[model samples]
Target: MSHSSPASSASAAPASIACTSLDYVWPDGTTVFDGLQVSFGPGRSGLVGVNGSGKSTLLKLIAGELRPSGGTVRVTGEIGYLPQNVTLDTALRVEDVLGIAGTRAALHAIEAGDVREEHFAAVGDDWDVEERATAALAGLGLGHVGLDRTTGELSGGESVLLRLAALLMRRPDILLLDEPTNNLDLYARRRLYAAVEAWNGVMVVVSHDRELLERVDQIADLRGGEVAWYGGGFSAYEEALAVEQEAAERMVRVAESDLRKQKRELSDAHVKLARRKRYGQKMWDNKREPKVVMGERKRQAQVSAGKHRIMHEEKLAEARERLDKAAEAVRDDDEIRVDLPHTAVPPGRSVLTLRELRLRHGARVDGEFELRGPERIALVGRNGAGKTTLLRTLAGELDAVSGTADVHVPLRFLPQRLDLLDDELTVVGNVARFAPEATPNEIRARLARFLFRGARAGQRAGTLSGGERFRATLAALMLAEPAPQLLLLDEPTNNLDLASVRQLTTALESYEGALIVASHDLRFLESVGVTRWLRLDGGLRDTTAEEVRAEMAGEG
Candidate 1:
């Protein structure tokens, strides 16, 4: 599914990181990893798992950001880590973020004929530090950015890359990147992929981006507090998982059948023993043999019956254990399901139109454009290109600066903020607010498909995790009254794990409506069945998926 080539990380004999009998527990007594053992060698490894399966937690432990509750992490050299949510002082310059401000300052002092012992020491072996810094930034598509530029001036995506550029500058023996492509545009992601391919040291990336995963040398799937290694990239890992799941399912079926047979055999043995007891009693009453002989025979029969029952019971217990083990091998990754038939639009129905539209954010759509039928449009652009502003205008949340925007059908907008739900309300209560006509039972039933089953549906919105909050907000939007025929989603896949992204796609699959989704994730767009590609640079222009791919490749 990825257009990018596999990242062939330069082979090197780098230091390895080993976590022996690692154990970590939260202050609230929630255990994340207990006696977990894993190791990473020099190469690019894609660390993957379902949301909250401790992918990020494990990375933090490796980076020494979090300490294990009971075990030790042994590393051979320095480690560079780019966390998922990167926050830096806006006042800091680009050089500061790259960790070369002091070196550069020292080099400048020496060049200015003001060299002192401290200055010379500071400039040790880093006389070309500035040059290397600029080249590293350039390699990551940050060449045009001045080292003196303030961090606040860069967009969200740029900030992420700048941080990575800093890590690259350090040249650590091990590098850890968490969701590196979360906010990156096509160009930045391509550059990041290039950097990943060029890395010769130990590297482990925790990302849901399929393209990023596809470039890795191998995959380390962390689930249930353990790591499972798969050679090759994301595609190979998926194929292997499919085969494994199939075998696990077959074992489950066999186990169940064996359990049933054991139970039946046990029941038959009980019936036979009861019949023998009755026959022995009849013989005793009829005086068919001496009292002593009848008593001895009865005693022997009871002893044999007890042993027979014990054997069958043990077999049944063993079968039950097998069934449990088999079931554990099968994954229960949750998926979102919806039936929005009412949201469907006819092929000839008009959906959305923009006429000489000019958004308040300074992005303009030239002339007139109309969306007909249930077209799935992928709105793509660089950061700060006003994709979100366009979606806001479509959703009627923002008045256009000029021109007119009209929606010809019921519509819903899911913004990147995900602030639609009220924290005071429970999951079911929030959905009920959106669909007042829907009964409480109906709402609960639908929420189950969103993976909020039973008590989970009763959980307050404020208590939801990142993935859960996204699902709750999405449920409220898609299940609203007068069902949305035109959905405008801005960066829907951002911050979502791979499973949640698939869940979003699953929900979209059931939505028979027009969709305009703004996202930088290529695989996600393809998964959601995007029919049209709209690139919003200075102007909203029509493009193709292949063209987008070509741009990413061509620019690279």
Candidate 2:
């Protein structure tokens, strides 16, 4: 259940956050925000936009990580921020990590005399600290884990929950979370959504999770450098967008009609004037009765000038009207399209064969593993358990120190870090670089299909947001002339919003190739139809789906 605060109370005025005429410009002369004005208040709010739409950048501005180039961004109360993906050092234990904040709060409360001396004595300083830490962890479903367990030893899902626990301990008035559920497992993601649903404070969440958005009070769509605040959740926002797009389309049609009419009228007037001129020239060349012919020619010329002026004015007015309508239509609805080439690959009976394969980092070793073709597999383990290393070896990016690796078919890999991208190039340029055979126009067209259009296509890869870079890389891989028969992905959902991840999932579901992915996102794994799992501890072992679900439950 959600908690009620004074802001939500009947007598209190609704709390509001506002950005007034904000403008943000990068060092490279790119303008992300221009005269942008947005207001949000108590309850959950979603920030939605395509990749490179400055969603994360705007979140940072609100968090004070950046200052607006021209206007102001102001918030009424304390702000709590959760970044998209972050790694905590393994040296710090969960309790010690949470203690850093609890200790400070305890000291502040004591300094302020919030508790009496006797009360303090009854609850030992260290005891109270541990109690508070435990409560925080429990709230986030991490209470069962040993307090001394190193943060770095946690899995991707565990780390996300812990970070949220830490954020919650602060109890800020406004929470600014950027893709809070990016790396969470299915159960963890649901829990995170519950946490957001339970929050009473004002929250501006930058995420692509449709389910999460469904729980929000409002959705703020960031598009074309502006923010549109919808009164309801995702469904309502989508309905509204559809209505707006329809209206824009109607305006475009009207504009086109007016333009055609204007052109036709202009053409007719030109034809009439040319005919009169030709007649006058013929009379002059024939040297017919001078006075009568000259007088008639003069009269025709005067009439033609008058007609021309009237037609010019009408045409200009029509053109201006069409331009105005076109402008309105353009402003109301402009979307980037991503047209990924679907390459055809010959069906192969056996794509990959792993027979008693073992993997490990330098000195650490794991057990025997086996895999086959046309199978959907998931690799699950803690952070440093060599999940990525295993994928690398399977993809032939790395050589296994001991186990034999065998593959009978062509393969493609999408790494967690997007190592395939060149940071210096634009989104389109990067695609062209990877698929050098594609024409420049084809590359641009394809990039647009991925939602990198207009100036965004020109954005440097290093400067593109994490989501943008991922999309660009994925677009490049999928657009290859002959798609790989076996696809290997390591943490594919790392930086994507829930929506993008789902879209990608839909695409993968239709893929004909075999897939072996290493991810902490259980939802993504489930969405992609992972039939079997390879759990890597000291070694690899095949386990039932129920067993993996049990492990997740146990971790929680």
C-alpha-based local distance difference test score of model 1 = 0.85
- Global lDDT of each model? 0.85, 0.73
Report per-prediction Cα RMSD to one decimal. 5.7, 7.0
Residue by residue across 231-341, what tens digits does model 2's lDDT show? Answer: 789999889878887887787887777777777877777788778778877877777867786988779797877878687768768777776866665543333243433
Q: What is the lDDT of residue 93 in candidate 1?
A: 98
Count backbone overlaps in model 2: 9
* Predicted model with the maximum lDDT: 1
Off by over 4 Å in 1: 1-14, 27-29, 105-124, 338-341, 346-351, 359-362, 393-410, 417-447, 453-466, 479-483
Per-candidate TM-score against the hidden true structure: 0.86, 0.74
Candidate number of the best TM-score: 1
What are the clashing pairs of model 1? none
TM-score (C-alpha, index-matched) for candidate 2: 0.74
